[model samples]
Target chain A: MHIGALHISGVNLQEVEQKVLDVAVNIICDEKGKDYLIVDDNPGSEILVLNADSAEGSKILNNASENQVKIVFSSSTQSGKNIITMPTPVRVIALKNVLIKIAEQLYAYIISKKGHLKAVKKPTVLPEAQKIENIFQQLLQIKLANKCSLISSTGLPSIYIDGVNGRFITEKSTDDIEKYLNLDFNSVESKEISYEQLNEYSKNMPVAALNSILWRCALACSNGKLLPGHSENTPVKLTSWPNFSRHGFKPDYFKLAAIMAKQYISLMELNRQTQIPFKEITDFYNAAFAVDIIETVTDKSKLKKTGPIKSSQNKSILKKLAQRLGIN
Target chain B: MLQLNTDKIIFTGPVGAGKTTAISSISDTPPVSTDVNTSGEERKLKDSTTVAMDYSYIEMDDGTKVHLYGTPGQTRFDFMWKILTKGGLGLVLLINNDHPEPVKQMEFYLDSFSDFIDETGVVIGVTRTSINDQANIEDYQAKLFERNQIFPVFEVDSRSEGDIKVLIQALLAILAN
Candidate 1:
């Protein structure tokens, strides 16, 4: 349960380190032990905390070509790729979470170095239809946990039973949805809804709820395996921008997806580019696919190269002008 | 009376969005600023506020002069927003991410200049993102999408000439399209 010896060093981190050590019983700050290192400008530490705006932080980061060190930057802004940054006036919860992640990484490293790590056998794959059903059941579980009704927006039970529709009308008001539901499912004994039917019903669900269901479906359909159309070798592109406003998705999710879809790049390539967790990226892609916002493009020609503008000449002029005005 | 035949780009946003700083960063000549000492709550943030407007200019390689006009940030002076936008080729809206309600501010400015945005073009430069990460570039894009508008949004340090240039280039690209 003990996270190995951790060292803490940084101009801004003195108080933070004291507070963290007081609360985190497992983390030990020791200079003698090399299991885990936390530093600002000092090299050889596993975790580097640097002030984003300070010259010292910049100098250290520039000189850090070391491999296998997890960098944690203390800044007032959001953390970028590879490094985990805690906002200034660091919160105890955020620090604890970062430590937990570091502990997991350390455990994995130790196991690999000891050659004790073994590959687990893959589970038997379920039929495509059955897999979708499994996903739908999971979605139901989520809705139930959230105290949401299993009934579709159209007032019919989302989960069909036998040949008749299940009768659990959560909302008694007879609106257009109720009328449509009654006309569509005349009989009560309808079997389970298929994936396509679920997708169609999604249009009626609130954007937030629909996004949740779609994400769950993607996870279930893929069965923890690479999706049929997605792979580490193939490049993926966005067919269209996901209506984040309508979908109630965080715009950041769409931006990441758009960046990946702009060019044909494998998920691994995207991982390298963004340094975001592989699982998170795959989950987002799966959700995007379920909502029909992205596609796999075999033709490389279709991939648009929308890189940043090359401004070597312009940059020089701007730099000189900025220096003159003391704007840098 | 002599009039300068120069195309202009209007920079407007809520208070403390760094419009004046951005103009000063890229302006070839010293900016003509009408700033007054602050006496109210705004004084807590800065010592001065632009009362009227700030003006500067840049000369392109082809000798085309592009005038930069910065509108006063407070809505009390919003009467000048339309006046400043007149004959403007595009709008550069700089939003301060540290503001309590950046998204709301974004919507207000976008709606305020919707007609101008539609007629010409608009680019958003979010300043102080390094200090405030609550509203990132993607969040701005989402807000724009809600209004059924598509515009380029960049995270910029208004004082950085390179960062401002990137924003200006994005605006130019949008105009070209």
Candidate 2:
């Protein structure tokens, strides 16, 4: 039976093409005896007839294999068994059978290889739009967590501040701080203090007591009320032990803040100790201040000017972090 | 007969993070799933959740077949998490950004599979990030950093074949390294 258009590529291109066409129509024609379009230059032609002995045929075969395009070759050709081949004499029936067989084999191969062809492409670096979106997301989370808000200064419900016991004992009537601390509010004096007075009162207290009072004060602060003298260089100390699991601060930051609270540390010192970004430290500072867990040390003489820390050190730390992340 | 030559990678995430959909996207064959209708709180997110696991495979031209297994997201089915990771070469942790606590969920999964992760490698795919970008890949990376971990994290769409491939490819690359 006549196969469809076959591209003849060999030393004797014209002769092969004509002979194949005649054989296809006269002896191997299909039920309708239709003429096959045996072209010499149709690269898109599904069927290819290549002479085994010719260099051009070898090149075509190599090209086809590289492109994953199957071709019909003369039987004498030294090629893989997976390739389709027919005798060089161009017997009419043999040619017909070989063409039909190649078509069937190609169909089966295509069917079997469909899944392999569907492998998806690899992803590239995130685009700027995606990066901007990511930043927006982080900001939203910070806002939702109230990490971005300033600690309120006044009208906080009366909390019992006990320096000797190292606790900011709150009234049993208050639901906010008690839910977190789970402490008995009984037998404690309830007093309301302004942000300035609380800061003044915390100056003489032990670090532990200061930690408790400040954390309570921070918790008591109204949302968006700025803590007094809250600045990057402000000397601050953690007053109480940080409950990491409860607070949800990153472990490293929590550890750094814990270290800072034990000893009076300026915001800059905390940043240097933790290598955490200033903005993050500020967020933590605000949160800590609002809850009265952190207090500013007014003794400027104790705050030695550690000098200007190099951004290179911070860069190296970031580089190390990026390296750990396997990002070049 | 024991199929010792077969290799596999595990997929895990919170409920509705698209673990099943991810496997189905890249699997050469229709994946086998043991999903059932989600009851109680989980139903609010999706109708069905994977009860046991999801399974599918991709056969390379060199005759190597890599199996994909997805674990159930809910903690109630966490028992299957360890079971499915028996022969896994690595893990692809898919976190849904739109979830109430995406970072918390990431930490939970990483902790749950820390043993397997310590043995093999892991790559994270944060899905639905476009829907809610508040908890980005860096946030997850920061959490991993706290654990002293460094993993490839990407934003992916579970329904996209390309995104799933990128996630799997990143895991394979980590394994190769």
Candidate 3:
């Protein structure tokens, strides 16, 4: 019997042709929903055929509509699909007859689903952009040219830095420093201070690395955005590692720093590789840039994804193990 | 019963870096361990130490299993690292942050398993920072940077299940990377 187009999934085409010696079944290939690819409903039309012999096939089958027909040679059960099970040692003619019938049903199903469709919008949460322009960037910018001790303030809410020596003095504790750095850059101003005054201010105070303090400031004040010059799309690597131990870091920072230092990766690529939010990767870049650990990567060939490749079966097994151990 | 014969993840580090403890924290079954009393200066740090590989496995729901093997931390057993890592998935190198030169010990392991790591991948877990706090994570990362290599180093308390799990997950993630 002549049949119409079919988006046949979980079935082999060559085996079907070998079975149906004389019947011509037009196949329309598509990468979309396995069953919906064939839309035409005529006496004879094009069709798409798919076979569920592997994990990828199972994925397509699982995503298929519950109403559409599912044909399987093995005795495997799909959750909701109308499965037409065939024994493993079935005759060739039986397979061809099943295909013809399934193709006709799939076409009629498509014709029935004329304009009923809905767009699925995925929900995404983005970090809010900070309202204030920033205070640390201006101070850090002047740090390059001043060539002397620079203090953001003279009193308790202050930062004492000697960039040349890599020593910094800050009265603001770690918890309060972010608050102080978030203030409007226009309102507060930094001034050049004498070394004598810097020494006196640092008395009984712990002298830490300037980047140790500024790394925290850069991350907090940069507001989920990268500083100019370093594009997210172009690859860059860290010349030196960020001091993650000295201060608290977002979890993604570890992977980002490791991946970037291992090889040149664009910030966009970093986010993609690590599955870390783009905002967090941007913040990491800003902090790394402030610490002078960033270098432009001229050779693009150095880019190779770091991580193990696994088959879908192994991936599921890993997921199950992670869940059983409560590691997720 | 079906068994995954080729799946293995190796754990190795210096003496008293908590290699055995890290394995116990993540393994589904109690890890079979072999340890002996420490002598000389090593005795000052810990009472005993692992002298051979600790073996354990976690059976996934679908009957697939991931085997965990922790090598002896003593330098004398360096030959076993390669044997244990043959056809392994990745390496988890634990370093005692309290050690005088934890970075050096880390370097030793990294060098010892360089070929395996180049073929597979590795994750570092820094244990016992509260004891002495001599070494830091940045120092380890800097050394890796200097060596032109990079791996995730985390401050992990080997006794804490969550910490060891995170380390394993990091190793698995990079292995998957």
lDDT of 3 by residue, A45-118 (tens): 33323345567656655665555565544434233436554434343323443454454344544455653232
TM-score of chain A of 2: 0.26
lDDT of 1 by residue, A1-328 (tens): 1234444444334555545433432222221123443433454545555455566666666565455343444443322334544445544333443454454455556556765443321111222343223333333233222122333433353431111111122133322122332232323232344323433444433232233344545544444455443466667655434433223233235335446533566778777877766766676676665443444653456556553333343344433333343332
Query: What are the TM-scores, per candidate, against the unseen true structure?
Result: 0.40, 0.36, 0.61
Superposed by TM-score, candidate 2 places the C-alpha of residue A279 at a distance from the truth, in angstroms, of 35
Proportion of native contacts in model 3? Answer: 0.18
Best by lDDT: 3
- lDDT accuracy of residue B46 in candidate 2: 96
Candidate 2 local Cα displacement, residue B90, angstroms: 0.5
Ranking 2 against 3 by DockQ, winner:
3
lDDT of 2 by residue, A1-328 (tens): 1133333333333475446544543332221123333434454445555565577767766665333333344545344534444435454333443444344344444445653342221111122233211211222222222121111213333333332112333333423343423222232222344323443454443333224334343433323333333457766665432433223343344345435633567778767866877666665666564333344554456456332222232233323322332332
Residue A295 lDDT (model 3): 60
Highest TM-score among the candidates is held by which one? 3
- DockQ for every model, please: 0.01, 0.01, 0.10
**C-alpha local distance difference test of each model:** 0.54, 0.53, 0.61
For model 1, state the Cα shift of residue B67 in Å: 0.8
Docking class of 1: incorrect
Instruction: Judge candidate 1 at residue A17 and give its lDDT.
Output: 58
Question: Model 1 over residues B1-177: C-alpha lDDT tens digits?
Answer: 002422777889887999999999888887788898887877766788887888888876655566889999878999888778876777899999989889789899989998988776677788888798776554565455445345666678899886776566555544442
